[model samples]
Target: MVALAKEKQKELVEAEKYVSEVYEAIKERNPHEVEFIQAVKEIFDSLVPVLAKHPKYIEHNILERIVDPERFISFRVSWVDDQGKVQVNRGYRVQFNSAIGPYKGGLRFHPSVTPSIIKFLGFEQIFKNSLTGQSIGGAKGGSDFDPKGKSDGEIMRFSQSFMAELGKYIGPDVDVPAGDIGVGAREIGYMFGQYKKMKGAYEAGVLTGKGVSFGGSLARTEATGYGLVYFVDEMLKHKGLSFKDQTVVVSGSGNVSIYAIEKAHELGATVVACSDSNGYIYDKEGIDLDTVKRLKEENSLRISEYVEEHPHAEYKEGCSEIWSIPCDIALPCATQNEIGEPSAKLLVANGVKAVGEGANMPSTLEAIDTFLENDVLFGPAKAANAGGVAVSSFEMAQNSSRVSWTFEEVDAKLKETMASIFTNSIKEAEEHGVPGNLVIGANIAGFKKVADAMIDQGVI
Candidate 1:
């Protein structure tokens, strides 16, 4: 069996040679492009069976069309600082795939923003959005201007300048970018305000993750985190267990982790740890969500601050070690590759039964393998963290209909969508003779949808 699996892997690699060539060409243009190439290649390699199953996809050269972005926009954003100094930054919007519908994703704002990262994210978004059963396509855009420690005026100016150029490419029926990472409600508001100013119209659907009064969905802030929990709940149900008495350890004290902890606690789970970039706080007795929220949301303090308020809690200087602590379930919501092989081994050894990703690609490939080998109920990011984009699609629907869905209505829809995604992923994995390998299942399931669309569209 091992030999046959190795042979199949080799065949898959060989079949992807042409797609690899395109990625190599991009890499030659810029060495930094390798990251994006590797990310896309991983998905492509797992999808070889789909190509074999549907010869029409190969006949139509769908791989080429899938990798190539439908549209790309680049522009310079010049904003003035409080000192009247003009700061110029480069911005990009990659509308990766829209065979399903208009491009949809998030706008990230950080110094780490680059074409490679955006492309990788956009590629992942394609699968993530598809799993939601929504009609939206995949796209991602952002600027390399970091908002951290920046004055309000500077952020406003940067956002306005960024939107002045971005507004030309985005619309209610075209590309829609929501908040991601550094981009949040404040940045969305600033960009939306500028977009409205330039277009001379109020287009609320132009961007998602908006403030509640500005047509944002009620659970938008909590969607990704809550969705992570929802996916885990379904996974546990298969094992005849639930979050009712489980203990969860989540990394990252940001939006996703905060809300995930909240939802886990609300569902009768004890959340023992939450981390930030610097470090994590562990309270075996269970974390104080209110205190954590105040420190993060109001004071904007590091997660270590929770230790001062809670005498029983301990703070660590490193975020990666959060997985070392024992828990019934683990959710890595910090950043890509934050959880690796060592972490995965630790969690499994500690008897962790499930892991639901709340961040995009948070687990390394080795980590994913470790989980699968241990028979851990794993939720791949594409299906697990899709709640954010799923709700964004709901917001788009409300905008098009000139109506707003009640909080209850939207939340119900999100729950149903997440449950369906898990069911589909499981069915696909089982059909492929890898019933527990959700990584491959998610890629194959998502690729089949887009591949079929490409064939139907006549090789566009």
Candidate 2:
């Protein structure tokens, strides 16, 4: 026992030094790119022991090359609003890696979109896609175009103009883009229409997240949320517990959160709260999914409107306060860095049994560290929230074969994929002598697969 402990300590020391060196170089090269730097640091910090085992990675400078994007495209997107005024937005697509396959990720259209943010998301996508063990690479694209308060015609025009430029770089088997924060069915429809117009071909595989009327997959809408619940179920089941009669608090009212609540209810768990950027809605009787869907999807109103229908429900002003509600499980389905040290401590104190991220990098480093130290069953975003992309791969396959799978078939596949991912992550963690460390386990497992592929491909 003493020798094993001493050897583990030495491994950690060597790992830390290697990680610090790589992190310093990344920080120096990418000045003022805080989000990108943070992301690179987090993954690098987790990869020390993995790197030490693979000397060829160091010889080829794979760490540095992987940190840099293979190709980044930036262009001007100009469209006319309903009032006949010309508006311009900056667009970007960062093809992070293509070793495993073509570029595959989502296109997010939010006001916060920037090069640093896109690069950070793209970098994370590389591992997220790799964890699925599918033939897909990592890429992310979007524009700083907020769709809120825009008329339907205005949005369609903006999407068309954006795709007019984006279509040139993307194709069915080259790079396929899906939807994220602000890019949903409506946006995808417009973009697909524009792509077809430009290419003069029906390339349904060029995009995911399409509505069911076209070549879209049936379970695409519910995949991410359902998959998250499925992953959490696997984790709890490992410890001989289930979501039966337990309370759950899920952040965000978007598609991921709503369907997660739906799946939780289907699995016999009572969901108590969900939130938006403005505030959160809490109903100890459990939130009504119909009302949430109506307010957010139908009316496009804030979550505060949910209180009007359910008078007993409370509407809080701050979105982060939702973490204060005691629950058996907490799922951050919202944006990046939503949970920091304070929220992590609060959730731990409130007895959150597990945390599964539905959104990318929803928890800060401090929060993740705290969860690890406290022995909380924390699921990293790369492994936990990969269901959406996994299903997207299914969609691509369906389109390629000119077939549409039934909803049951797709849902079953998604559940199996999520379970496989959870099992693999645990297997990797245990083998690396860091049982229960999903973050490290996911990083190492995904990195090794990509690294070996990159090496075999001869350092392109």
Candidate 3:
């Protein structure tokens, strides 16, 4: 195992050397983007065979340019609260690539927002978008503002102020941003309204995840969650198992967790646990979707509220303990690094057959190593969470055509895309003699398409 890891590390180093010239050229401009650069390098290293097979990409220096964004926009968002206090936050928009089409990605608003996080997300978006076989390029933007306890009015003012500066660089053709993390339908509405008011015209395509009354597609809210289940279903089918009768635990009480729970229940799985940052609630009986949704969306209450309402449920104080519960399937729908090596060991010891990431990089490097070493079926974040961006790309298509797709139509498309992504990743991994290494498969498959496009376009 140590020898195998060394081999993988060596391959990664070689891949970095292959793109070192491009990395050095952009290093100055992209200072503090080491995480983003590291992820790109790791994926690029795994694609050495693909690059060798497709020499045209090398002939055109696609590897060099694809690692760098086409444009990066930074601006300040200042807003006045209802208390008459002025607040300031930093905002970012990283337009990673536009070789396939206009930039398309989500805007993540959270207290943790930083250029490095946005760049990592945008970098991942490049491959996730490509895996869908769509024409959308990759971009991501957001602010450092936290909307947790903020009043609707306060959030509205902040979103408007943020858009006032962001409007200058984004458009349907140039770039498009949607909702992510702290940015939801409400935030999107505020930003969209501000963009229209500033431009003196209405362009629904400018932002996605909008309300249906505006331009949002049906199933957009549930796309990420449903797509997650669909991908897991495919993975299970490959192993001759299914979601039926499986006890599942999911983290996060937001959109992803809510719908993930709903779909898991629908698929005949008992979702035993779900959580939020403040704590987690577990019930022997499956969690009720309607009750969980109301507590989270309507009351803005924590998971503890659910425990209060359901006497049978138990609420744990810390968020990390959610992984300690025994389950057949575990979905990490929360933030990055929420699941570490110890938590991974607990899941493996308790008989977790598969672990799918519903959030971006929810597992740490050690956790991933533990899962891989245990031969646990693991779905990496890039492939698992690609559902959200895939639907956003679909929304972009609907907006471009000036038409909205029915929920059934959009949902069918999303399922098909997720299945295709799973198949492609598995196929690529098998080709590289790493049959279940979806992390490598996802990186290679996603990188090949974008790299080819970059090569075809030539030298930025």
- Structural similarity to truth (TM-score) of each candidate: 0.94, 0.97, 0.92
Off by over 4 Å in 2: 1-15
Better of 2 and 3 by TM-score: 2
Task: Please give, for residues 1-460, the per-residue lDDT of candidate 1 as tens digits.
Answer: 9998887777556556655665566567557675577677668767666655555666777776788788878889998999999889999999999888899999989888889888889989898888899888999989899888899899999999999889889898888999998899999999999999998999988999998888888889888988888988988997798999898999998889998999899899999999888989999999999998999888888888888888789999988889999999999998888888998999999999999999988888888889988889999899999988999889888887878888889889999999999888888878766776778788888888877887778755
C-alpha positional error of residue 338 in candidate 3 after TM-score superposition, expressed in Å: 1.2
Please write out the lDDT profile of model 3 over residues 1-460, one tens digit for every residue.
9998887767655545665666566666677776675566556656766654555665677766776678989998899988999999999999999888789888988988888888888887888888877888988889889987889999999999999999999998888899999899999999999999999998989999999888888898998888888898889999999999999999998899888889889999999899998889899988988899999888887789887779998998999999999999999999887998999999999999999999977887779889989988888878887788788878878877889889999989999999999999999989877787888888888887777677667565
State the displacement of the C-alpha of residue 74, model 2, in Å, after optimal TM-score superposition.
1.1
The ten-residue window of minimal lDDT in model 2 covers: 51-60
- Candidate 2: the clashing residue pairs are none
As a whole number from 0 to 100, the lDDT of residue 243 in candidate 1 is 95
Question: For candidate 3, what is the TM-score?
Answer: 0.92
Q: Who is ahead in lDDT, 2 or 3?
A: 2
**Stronger candidate by TM-score (1 vs 3):** 1
RMSD to the true structure for each prediction, in A, is: 2.9, 1.7, 3.7
lDDT (CA) per prediction: 0.86, 0.92, 0.86
